[model samples]
Target: MKNDTVGRLKMGYLPLAFVFLFFATELSSQVNIADPFVLRVDGKFYLYGTDDKKPNDGIPVLVSDDMVNWSGPAGNAAGKLALAKGSSYGTRGFWAPFVVQNNHMFYMYYTANEKIAVATSDSPLGPFMQQEFRPLNDSLKEIDPHVFIDDDGRKYIYFVRLINGNRTFAAELADDMRSLKPGTVVECINQSQPWEIISGNKWPVTEAPAILKHQGKYYLFYTANDFRSPAYNVGYAVSASPLGPFVKYKENPLIRQTDKIKGTGGCEFVTGPGEKLYMFYHAHADEQSPTPRRTLFSNAIFVPGKAAGESIFQVSENKVFLKSSAR
Candidate 1:
């Protein structure tokens, strides 16, 4: 059903209604987390997710400023544990953890027993130091590990492979942001639409990938089904470059599942202070249905018109309004 967003912003922009995410409450139970990953060092904003693996294979760090008050990743709160515990591929099963920063260092990309790794830190609150423990490609089944760096600076590395199931891949990274730059990998999107099937036609699904470039194109956001169904939301694809042939957005699932947040797909997109653009996700915190505990949300992503890089984005309307109040 190739999205319309009000007939493609009425042919050139002028439709703004939906704009959500202002969570601090609802589904309470002190918001346990899931697949979220965000980082913005100095101006302060660091959140990593999917923790609670019995006392410490570690991976839970929270600290927000106005992304609507997000403290408490557990116990002594103020949220800590930015990727600890040793690894040569063995230390529990930390699922997703993605961080990026260039020259001044700070480069963490995670996932353990299912492969995909990289760690190094100068700060972003980390004891992170896996120093190339290997697995960018060792046969498939990789994990979600995003890292996009473009605008003429080139450094891409979006992941998620599983042969015939969860597919989303990209390459081009070498400048020591930890290898990969041999043939430019590339295999962008998979899992054909129809609301991303679920049990038939090329089933399986996509994974969490987050790329955003605007104007010059290259928006790849992902997240399809079975992220504990409720139809795990979010979908996007478009590319002029950034290792792609991408093109899935006939008005696709650019974020869905609501009626009190039963699905919001693991997401990440950043930018702040005068640049704005925000989107951090995690929500399965059922108010009356699907539940498994996943709570950490945010919104605000715009691109209304006025031209610059060729405007056409509004995928930040999950609920579009929900005040703040959970702690």
Candidate 2:
């Protein structure tokens, strides 16, 4: 009789114990990761993000078996630096890294002090070495390097040119995967929509370039306005060609600040488990924080119908997508 009573007591405590452990693990594993990018390799999601939240760290990365749980080196992110600071290009300011694999090497296209550079590593988790310590072209005034290799085996790198009020441009990467093809560079998109105007945006800003090829159309997703401004939001443009004459979706901003989740922008799209398309983005920690720290969130993205144009892409739970996940 005593044994049966003890067993019941232990069973009752087990569920509470698990709930406590889950919260503890989540608090330790995930921190503020901004300008976030997630790459799925070997059935695992590897995350890389700007060094903004971490003090004195060059760049930080997180790893996860499932998208729900993430961790830095050794399962804590507070003091770890994945990419060291100080480079031939510039010492500081690394943001928005887009990583891809080719020829058994992982290539990270990232910004250093607002200049674009590349670093290579054998593994996704890297102390990536910068073999070519210079920007792609000393003449190309650009930042935010997002690399996309199309189904046809051709590669393209889309980047933001700060020259004309934060416009974006695309160029075909030469067969080597670093330098651009001589005459393939073209201006892709810029801010003209009304919602793009924000408080700190004196001129205009359309940055954070991410490309997706769907339904025989190239979709360019970008963020507008100052990231610090509450007006920051995500929008899309459609084009037939990778080097695009992209047309902005009539609805303009796709993801916007909700009463619950404010300042939603700077996102990347990746295929999650079950062939689902998910968007990983950063928003102010909650509605209360407003313009301060940014936290990473992932939500399902819906692309309806076979044809592409207008409201072809719909994001579920605009008011509470992040809230859907307990994390």
Q: Give the 10-residue window scoring lowest on summed lDDT in candidate 2.
A: 1-10
Which residues of candidate 1, in runs, are more than 4 Å off?
A: 1-27, 37-49, 52-93, 97-110, 117-169, 172-182, 186-209, 212-216, 220-239, 242-294, 299-302, 312-327
TM-score for each model: 0.31, 0.82
lDDT, candidate 2, 81-155, per-residue tens: 456665334466777888888888888888876788888777777766676578786775678889888777788
- Residue 145 in model 1: lDDT: 86
RMSD of every candidate to native, in Å, equals 18.6, 10.6
Q: CA shift at 288, candidate 1, in angstroms?
A: 32
Assess the local accuracy of residue 245 in candidate 1 as a C-alpha lDDT between 0 and 100: 94
Instruction: For candidate 1, write residues 78-121 as lDDT tens digits.
Output: 23466666633436677777878778877778777777878776
